[model samples]
Target: MALLTYTPEIAEARDKGHPIVALESTIITHGMPWPQNRDMARQVEADIRAAGAIPATIAVMDGEILIGLSAGQLDRLAQTQDALKLSRADLAIALATGRTGATTVAATMICAQLAGIEVFATGGIGGVHRGAELSFDISADLQELAQTRVTVVAAGAKAILDLPKTLEVLETLGVPVIAYGQDALPAFWSRDSGLKAPLRMDAPAQIAASHRMRARLGLPGGQLVANPIPAADELPSAMLSPLIETALSEAAAQGISAKGVTPFLLRRIFELTDGASLAANIALVRNNARLAAEIARALA
Candidate 1:
């Protein structure tokens, strides 16, 4: 019922049967600093539009879901320091309590499905965290992809996660994880994770048709189109390993875990790479948006 009160520009696009892509808002509030966060948000939307689709950046604000945010709201959210990062479990609570929050990958998928946006573009999917056996920290995004009827276009799982375990869970859930063009699954910021992709599709048409077929079969979930980062922008998994190790050590030493873990690691990597990670982040997100647009267009 609360989902019904949500309204934003993308709602009009949905009603009109236009191509629309769902975008997550955590990148604005938790991924980076204010000005850059707002800038990146705008650029991702621009990328989606340039690729011939409307972008719906999802968030919860003042007891309502915002399917797409205006520039001013985006700016304010990016600058607000204490905004909650919400996922499926907490999304309803945030909405019922009239709390403003940024939607994470999991929350975004749920909202996108409710809004009737069949395609979502994001930088990467969260997965089984490092040390999962002990920490038991798993991302809800994996389960979200299993039942939310919205195709998500992302580079791949973040490299800091246990990629092997992530793939195993995705497989167990009956989620379709299809690589875009390569035989290997991409590691966010890296073109190849050294693991062969379970499935691969080269064209947007094929991916869209598969989505349609799934619906025809009464399937409950969506597809994970694992688009690789542009070759020119890839950081190479080998090169990122040492840097990631250093960042992970820093995170552990600082007692950072759970949600705090990702942002901490990213910030450390940003400083470690002298901004290369951020640049790669921007590039891959835009690339995913473009690919998601193509899929949306194909769906149309």
Candidate 2:
């Protein structure tokens, strides 16, 4: 039996050799409220189309890995209240059980690779949690990047994580972290992470070339393109830092751990920022979709 299925649009694109950008479904299922999540998914897909690439929003449904989602499928997934959040460790379980699930960054990359897609876009990639030294609760997304071959475009690692530690881990895993058009890594909602990026690329073609070159050199992992959120849309790191600390404190106090921690912190930050965080998240995701489209085109 075929393990992967494609939407009509993606199937046509694949037949025609068109550029395609992979999108994670967790942003629709777990990142936002229902109608807004559906709306945002539509806008991001549109953004990819506008940039001349097809969008393949990957998910698992009815025991198959969906390479792309139709409007109805996206809507249904967005409204699902108990969708499993599948990562590398359990993506197969979700498929085997005939479950509805949303793909995390790791799972999305895996699906994209399986579908022969080369680029993925998201608001941000997960990273080392703040207390990972003790909890050892690093996100599987980092390890996925260390092995997966799909180039990821994002604002950067989620700012709520320990950015320095995340960078160290990426380095240790031999993952190339390239800041797009900047020397400093972006911090999700913020433009500057206050740490120097090991590599900087000024154009999508450059990124695509580096990606191809890495494969030629027999490198195991994909390159991370740390695309910054627009200055006008950024929350400013100074303002976000204190709010992040407070959210982390609240999560710890409430005994939130593991998968619960990120969503809890993001919701709290949204509340503390009076919705600015969500707005920034939407902006960054759209921005990444556009850039990923460009990279996909370059690769094609």
Candidate 3:
């Protein structure tokens, strides 16, 4: 039996050569709560459609990699309590065991490439954790970008991470971090991270052209398009920094580590901010989906 299964919509899109954007399932399974997660997933898929592309929200279930999910499947995933958070390390294990799993940024990239889809949209990419110098905890998302061929469009590295270390590691790995229409890298929910981006591209077509050029040159990795959150939707870095620090402190005191750290910090920050963080996250994800759709159209 094949390891991959495509939803009818995605299969049709592939057969017709329609532009398609890949979406990570973690945002639905692990990022938000029940109804809201389902709502956000639907909204993001709609945003891609509105921008002239099809959305392939990737997940794993019943020993198969699902390139896209139906509405019922999305709902079930959003409500499932024990979905494994599959990354590069354990994606195949989850597949072999037929466990339901949400694809993280790294897993999504691998699955997207396997499906021959070259663009993925997500709220943010994971990166070096704040205390990573001691913990040595870097995200596989960074390593995945260093080798995968699917271009990722994200607000930026999740703000709870150490942005400088993340950028340094990406630079060391030779991954192109291109800030879209901006000089500074975006800080997930914030429009600016105060760190200058190494590369910048203002248009979707330009991004697509660069992706093609990389393929022409036989590059091993994909480009990271740091699409800033819309100005109106952003939580200023100044306002968000203190909340992030508080969340980080709480997580450290609680002994949270590994994958648990992100969810804990995000949930804590959302509570500390009175839910503004999740609202901004939803906005940024939709924004990224729109841009990824445009880039996918250009690639097509």
Please, what is the TM-score per model? Answer: 0.97, 0.99, 0.99
lDDT of 1 at 144: 93
Worst 10 residues of 1 by lDDT: 1-10
**Candidate numbers, best TM-score first, in rank order:** 3, 2, 1
Q: Which 10-residue span in candidate 3 carries the lowest summed lDDT?
A: 1-10
Model 3 residue 112 CA deviation (Å) reads: 0.5
Clashing pairs in 3: none
| Candidate order by decreasing lDDT | 3, 2, 1
Q: What lDDT does the true structure give each of the candidates?
A: 0.91, 0.93, 0.94
- Winner by TM-score between candidate 2 and candidate 1: 2
TM accuracy, model 3: 0.99
Model 1 has a clash total of 0
Give the higher-lDDT candidate: 1 or 3.
Answer: 3
Count clashing residue pairs per candidate.
0, 0, 0
Against the hidden true structure, what lDDT does model 2 obtain? 0.93
